[model samples]
Target: MNGAKVDVRKVAGEGVTWTLLATLYLRAWESRLPEPILGDRYAAGAVERIDYDFAALRRRIRPASNQFLVALRARQLDDWSRAFLARHPNAVVLQLGCGMDSRMLRLDPLGKLRWFDVDVPHVIELRRRIYPERGRYTMVGASVTDDGWLEAIPADRPVLVVAEGVLPYLTADEVRTLLARLTGHFTAGGELVFDASAPWVARVAEDFRWAPRDAREIERWIPGLTCADATPFTTHHRRIPVRRYRALYRLIHAVPALRNAYREFRFTF
Candidate 1:
């Protein structure tokens, strides 16, 4: 198969695929920046594999600090995953809502670590075709809410679950149900890292007022789950390559309400 050509039909979607493209664009944009916070080599490669007019789409969108924010979140998430991998070399890493990004490949969780990327069937099908798979890395085609898919992972090793930019789309009840199943399945206890929006942000952005009010709101839903750490969107603002944007983010962070606007949480069970 030609490396430059990908089936346009497969990548067509208004939800996950668009988000995936946005993430890839952020990585590509960051890589070209004077001083990139996260130099994701795989992102450029991923973007090439998808058949779309990325430049046109990117230009059409508002040129805000979105790319900066996206890169910051990815850096933070990748850092957390790396930290976990360093501590638990043989951990089971589950990437829920795994889209077009090559996180498993980028992280390179080599050796005893078992890595699984699970998402809806269509996305998984496209991902499997685009991304390379190996003995340690596997792709599952199932919704994260399904219980049967959880059985495919070994029960022996501790699991490190990552769901980047996923939880907000789900209803609060759905999020709680998924967490309950995960905690129940991983009785040995492990870390679950994911992002969530504040109630105000959700209301304004999605016209949904049910976003978690705080990190504690998430911990309360799952038994024996403690939010080990929570970092707001501006936590890694200093990492932004542009000086003015970095200063603006610092100012935003100083505001109490805006500081807690959107946060990523790391939970330990």
Candidate 2:
């Protein structure tokens, strides 16, 4: 697997929004939006990608499961973000592995909280064209692994770390290192929120097939992070026979039983 070549910058635009995973989630959210939020171009950008290649993405990602999980995780992440902002209005909030997400606008904090979006150089470069970095919201074009930008985050206030649909891309050891860095640096009550893919997804992503190339890589070398609270995000799709589960089953080329093996987990460290 060419895990080494999976450019972090590719994570910025269509690689994120153009996939079945993101397109399906946006369609559902757009359908539910009240007119006031429509003017927000972040959401519009994602929806545009979907409208552009609705057919190709749908064919590759095979929507049903990806859409359900992404939307569910979005709710979890937004809720945690807004709650933290309410308490530590001046807190530093980091969105790790933030793709073309509308999080800054969705969880618009009312105070001096510094919201930083951290991703690879290419992704941040693309984002620069769309969202301007203001006093409150900022963009960092550094890979999460490198420590150079850790200083960019305020060491004073507690940081609420958020990773949605991101952890799976990294190898287990890298994930552990990232978590240890976060917890060791922050005080208690400063939490990390992120999701985990089932071993099934890891199996499919063995070569970055549909997900991150490193999914399988991390499982072996790195031990899982042990946190104050690590719980699986428990919510299932409407009950349907295994044969009928569309999205989960679409990756049959790799794992034939992948359809019956759908599972989602969310954890903190």
* Best candidate according to lDDT: 1
Instruction: Compose the digit string of candidate 2's lDDT tens values, residues 1-269.
Output: 11232222353445543332354345344345343212234555544442244455556665444444455456556666677667777678888877667777767734256788887776666566555677788888887878878776776776788877666667666676776666656554365666665565667565322222333333332334334333233232332123354334344324534432332322333
Name the lDDT value of residue 120 in candidate 1: 88
Q: Given candidate 1, what's the lDDT at residue 225?
A: 91
Instruction: Assess every candidate by TM-score.
Output: 0.92, 0.66
- For 130-206, candidate 1 gives per-residue lDDT tens digits of 78688888999898877699988876778899998877877778788888988888877789998877887887884
Name the lDDT value of residue 65 in candidate 2.
46
Candidate 1: stretches off by over 4 Å: 1-4, 11-16, 60-64, 109-112, 207-210
Which sections of candidate 2 miss by over 4 Å? 1-42, 49-54, 109-112, 187-189, 206-269
- Weakest lDDT window of 10 consecutive positions for candidate 1: 8-17
Q: Pick the candidate with the highest TM-score.
A: 1
Return the lDDT, model 1, position 10: 50
